[model samples]
Target: MPAGLVALALGGFGIGLTEFVIAGLLPQVSRGLAVSEVAAGWLISGYALTVAVGAIAVTAATARLPRKPVLVGLVVLFVIGNLLSAVAPNYPVMLLGRVVAALCHGTFFGLGSLVARRLVPPERASRAVAVMFAGLTVSNVLGVPFGALVGERWGWRATFWAITGIGVIAAAAIATLVPYWAGEVPAGGRAGKVPAGDRTDSLRAQVSAFRSTQVWLTLAATALGYGGMFGAFSYLAYTFTEVTGFSSTDVAWLLVVYGAGLVAGNMAGGRGADHNRDLTLIVSLAGLTATLIAFGLLASSPAASVVLVFLTGVFGFASVPGMITRVTDHAHGVPLAAGANVSASNIGNALGAWLGGLAISAGLGYTAPLYVGAGIVLLGLAVMTYAAVRQAHARETHSSPNSARSPDRKASM
Candidate 1:
């Protein structure tokens, strides 16, 4: 409800638009730049790769800096990138613009989540994250379509010009609304325990948090769980039009339905995670696995495909809040964990898209990607179950009396 949260969401909206709108405008961009279609596609892949690297490297570099200023600077960088894209006369220049914009992408989400959590009580931390991410979902539902429309009416450069305007607005809002103290600590943080003059925000300190086995497990779970759904989603247009017999135009509307589901699932997932983080993640992954398999079986039926695609969005995104929460929780206040989690998610994105493409090129049917996706999600479920069991065992070991007593010295004591 805070104006600051709205500003953060606006920033998210702008960044999300930059990331996805290109997919719809790829053809226009390719022709404009006089490049091969495959080369234009690198804009997306290169941006993604930059985001993954920047998520960790940039976040670590700025771990010791004030978060508000970092966010504001990142938005300024975003604006510059869009301006370059709007005026780019060659393919290489456009590629440079995308790379510039991407360097700030993951760090924004990572730092934004931390700031969002700081704005509220621990009980509502995940919900705050959900609110910020809502902007991302809305961008998919509205922004991508609008960008495509603008490109069709004018030129691809015109769309980037509009996005540049968005970046300006987001930067202004963030600079005006977000408080400096939002970067200091959460409501229940170690503020008093650490001296103001002797604060520890070094990269080495942040990296030490990875010493926890639970953190590694959570990262793996994020990569696998998120990858599973994206594998199917990457080829959704083909499945809907070719496999389900929907018209090309109908595929666009169906994507809107899936986007709507994403919005709903994001909100619901946040609330559920607030109550029980681990259980929410497990259920979401399990549900996604089932939904994908069912989708594969019913791909030929238009009605079933429509219903199942929406369900896939719901189950797929429902794990997100829990995933972010789990990573930060296990990190025990480490600054880089949130950024690392962002990197992990992007890694999953690349993996899913590649794996799904492989299934299609192997001469399997369009529905085959969905089956492969289901199997990947099943692997995620197995990993999560193991994490849960390990957690339970650690708790049991800590609670046992023998854990506290020295056997050689104290039989009675």
Candidate 2:
């Protein structure tokens, strides 16, 4: 990988930190701000909502700008968001900082994928993107747990302060290390590789991406699929503590195993996607649904619960690349459409949280989110399977009588 990839990874790291760091600091923040836990949860909801809005709008507005300056601007937004969060004097002010930070979330991943593609050769684009996203997975494993620990001792404000410093370091590294490409292909491309000479082509010209139904379906998959995942994951610490009887310290260690699973899943998905995008999506998803349901059922035993959570992370996150590629494949020319998919992901995040809360309000057990999550994911899987079958049938209808003998590739479920 190029040194420039390091800078991209740094950007990913700051994003990773900002998104999950609040998990650790939530109790502290809720106490300090004199707010109920439910109200304090707005910090996450507000951010995810804002990010979903900005991912498409911001990325589209900047689609034609020079790559280097745009990336720099994003990093600037990242720094300011963290600084604002770190130093807020009141809860409202703190929410304001979070909103600012949220604006950077979707656009960075969208643009960052573009940058990663340009920094490496054709065969390695997916791997390149995975490496950058690894920063995010690492956050789940290390950043959230440690941030919680820091807040436990140093106060929640200090956690944001440290994140702010990381943002600064990330911005500096990006400015120094990333190469200036006056014209490079946007990282998210349709199908296979595009030539270097074509790298600087205008996103305006690729308007066809918006016209594809497959793109929209894939984007919906991201929202619905991840919504189910977060529906369970958002309340993980609470569940582990109450249901599994793990102490605070043990919760952190279990998350480490989850993180390891996430890391492995991302790498494997990249390799798997490059081979067959459809198959990768189907396999990852079926596994994800099974694991989530299993976690809910098997919570009776510490050992069973531990293993289920690990599999949940592994299967759940593995779909990320396939989802990304699936959207890009359908997005062909529309860079903003592709970018919009990132925001769709956060939208799912918020939706999942809301539905999960609904289950608890209705007096379901602590494990209700798990079952709720499984049902929702199964719904998403059904959508994908339907789309795949319809697409296959359409293809079959178009084939010539002579060519109809061609091998049938059943849509992956």
Best by lDDT: 1
Question: Residues 1-413, candidate 2, lDDT per residue (tens digit)?
Answer: 68888888888888888888887778888999898898788998788788889888887787777667777788789888888878887889889999898888887877777676668775666677777787788777878777888888888888888888888887887778888772244543443433233432355344545555666677777787888888988777777888888987888788888788888888787778777766777788788899888899878778988888888888888888677656654554345765787888788888887898899889997889988888878877887776666656656754757564424322211
Per-model TM against the reference: 0.93, 0.87
| CA-only RMSD, every prediction | 4.0, 4.2
Tell me model 2's lDDT, rounded to 2 decimals.
0.76
lDDT of 1 at 58: 88
Model 1 agreement with the true structure over 31-88: per-residue lDDT tens digits: 9999999999999999999999999998888888889999999999999998999999
- Cα error of candidate 2 at position 262, Å: 1.6
TM-score quality measure for candidate 1: 0.93
lDDT of 2 at 385: 75
Looking at candidate 1, the ten consecutive residues that score lowest on lDDT are 404-413
Candidate 1, residue 384: the lDDT equals 83
